[model samples]
Target: MTEFILPSNANDLNFRHRLPDKRLAPWVQCLWSMGRPGHLTESRTEKFYPDAGASLSIKLTSPHPIITLCFNKTTLIETLDTTAPCLGIRFKAAGTHCLLGLLPEAFTDTHYRLDNELEPLGLQGLIPVVERLYQSDSQQGLRLLETWLLHRLESQPPANSRITKIVQAIGALQLPPQQLGATLGFTRRTLERKLKREVGVTPGQLVAYARLNRARHGLLATTLPLTEIALQCGYYDQAHFTHAFQSLAYETPAAYRKRKLSQIYKA
Candidate 1:
């Protein structure tokens, strides 16, 4: 399990440490983990939105059009012309990569400060193929394409103890928003600020997503009962756990497990 929580905006900021599909043990998700603004090629007008952490993103479905990437803490985002989207990958920190053919920067902070053009840093030469897959309306193709893309990234940097500890705590227990803030040794407001910049979600949202993700993995990786799973994930009781599971996953815990079991049996 990773130390940080990845929030998927399109799916209620849903999180999973790994791929849920059984056949794809090595798959990495291809779409934005946070809220997806739109279809891959919908001519997005970004306005300096904040995110959880620095990660790789690619334009897999655009019309092979040139998308611009600019770094401007002191200038305007519109003053720059379109750069090549084929090599559009963002880094959250510096000192991440030494070679420029795969990723653009060695930095991880989202504070953009430099002007980068179309240049592959991690991806060798397979951007357009992803875009073609995206155009075909094949989500499976898109996901499979990312398995190839994620393989090219540098290994995740050594995790910070501060963040890792938080992840571990969440694993052991799930608490309300205020209590969670206190556990982190910060006010809810402060926790919210740091999470938005570094963690990419509020403490409450992270807890919710992390809990749901745990239950998801438990359903696939084991055959634990709903009550047992609920207690293991730190829910107060089965009722509360069921409420949370349904709120986030759009299905009751038992129904979800049944669906999974059904899929496996059918296969």
Candidate 2:
């Protein structure tokens, strides 16, 4: 997985992130918090890339806090409310199934209230504790959250080893979708079904997500030419890369890179 980095304008908001405890590292990606800064007078937008993962978010600023699970199979752009303080737990690819025993396919590309969803799994008890911590100290809260996750992990069944292997293989981008199934000893149909149930995407979609993720990292982290970044991330050429990125991100690569650079310079 790519290292998590806050946006260039993160300092303007109350944003923080913590790595998951070692015991929970395989399933949990990172814990994060975001709040509107008191001095800020306007709302902002947050751009989410396609990561083949899900996030459990709690709107702590609400009168009655509610937990929402957002599963992203494609890019999402959402406006942030200036009055809401939120906490999030991002799950690794296929990690929701391992940790929560929920099929991700049911929640892909949308958000849903998790109250009813978790109750069926006997995990509704966790909601109150999450709310309590959000109202407390950040450091202590994160520690407590990790402790809770560890205890919850103990009660869950062992994660499917095949899913773990599949996630790793997809991230590595070592083979095409067709070859990936044969390499893993699964027929194409079986691979599609398995990935959809476990990861909320087909093998082809997951591979595309992985490639785009690598390309995004390259755009933000290095000064390499577009063609180099495209080729490195498995695209056929620069045109192919730009088209795919624009289709999902709603902006061309040059525009994204320029906008981000402008933000950093202004910051």
Candidate 3:
């Protein structure tokens, strides 16, 4: 885990993100946590967008915390009631298969409890960390998690570096599925199978996420016209861009931009 940072808006939730250490960088993308404990008068629900990889999340305030293997989904509405805080270890696109000996596709659009799954996989000892986390600070909890993950790395078979590279390439170039196979020197079917097994989404889905992510960055960081942003992000037209953006973001690009700017002003 990383240092927690609260959002500037007093009414908003807290979100902290930290990059993994060098040794864990290949398998782990980053660690993140979010919460709204102080504002628990009414339950708050948030929409979470899809990303490129899988995440292992723990509901911190739960009495019996269960580690969940969460796969990327279309759009998810997460509600905070008694469990107002949560922490997650986000893995690289291929890290799930390498670390857990499981196909990412099985967990797509869903989550699985790791308690029952890890025991049979000889990973029962790692389950105790959840209980330990109840007594530890964020830094300590993250340390424990990394230690366990490193141990798992030592015991399990190595992850496929080639698949990792392919994922990285897709992100970097924002290549569409139809074009990705030719660039990566793999057939479409082979790429699809490997990504389904390791990354939990098809190449087309990954490309869509990449495009939307690019559009988001452009919206927040630059004053480019929506038309230009849409074209640059590979959308056929403004309508197409707006539809895709709203699907993932739950807001129009203009609205998202206004909200982001408002947050900046508040900060």
Candidate 4:
């Protein structure tokens, strides 16, 4: 299940669920959480869901790529990490009109295929729909939500957790491929192949993305020195770290810290 932590019940923007589980599909969802002034605790299982364009939408707008997230379930359920809390704007399963007003294949049902590399669905796809909903009464909001999400989740099985586990393991690593592969109980080649099969990226690429995400958080949340941050995040040195950051985040670490993050303490 997708977990959401509501800081206050009295708050108007309470996000309970977005509905349906795709490999990670809620292509375009929305929530006030992105602009939240404070920080929130998200465990590793629900660690920050990082994508090339994971969002922070303030206004309702166009649909974006949907992501379906499933929880990790194992033989030893107690041992496997289970729940994660988050808040975001997201797409409703099979909400045809909500996703760019496009009809399904007209013959087929699904929008994305195994090899479909979707471009980012942006805010414009959602605003009109949301604005219309907002202008209506509270019952209308619930009606809109029901119309979008309640229709199909019952018919579909939830996504498997294997993909989530693979992603979590890869993202957890702070070492090179051989070392990380060993930690994940697979050979280097096997790890690479499986990761690509499940996640559409190589193990090394996943790690690189993960490393940049970790650095972004640290640079924003802590006053830790660059050298210390670099070492902790698995860089051979600050130079390599900076190079990777530039490639991944499109800015030098220092610049991102100063320009993008004025003060981002955890919630």
Which candidate's lDDT is highest? Answer: 2
Worst 10 residues of 4 by lDDT: 73-82
RMSD of 2: 2.2
- Which of the predicted structures, 2 or 4, would earn the higher TM-score when compared with the native? 2
Model 1, C-alpha of 15: deviation from truth (Å): 19
TM-score of 4: 0.47
Tell me how candidate 3 scores on lDDT: 0.71
Which ranges in model 1 have alpha carbons more than 4 Å from their true place?
1-188
Best by the TM-score measure: 2
What's the CA error at residue 106 for candidate 2, in Å?
2.0
TM-score of each: 0.44, 0.91, 0.82, 0.47
Tell me the tens digit of each residue's lDDT in model 2 across 218-267: 99889999999999999999999999889888898888889888888888
Off by over 4 Å in 2: 36-41
Candidate 1 is scored at a TM of 0.44
The reply for model 3, stretches above 4 Å from the true place, is 1-14, 34-42, 81-85, 174-185, 263-267
Q: Ten consecutive residues with minimal summed lDDT in candidate 2? A: 34-43
Ranking by TM-score: 2, 3, 4, 1
User: Which 10-residue window in model 1 sums to the lowest lDDT?
Assistant: 72-81
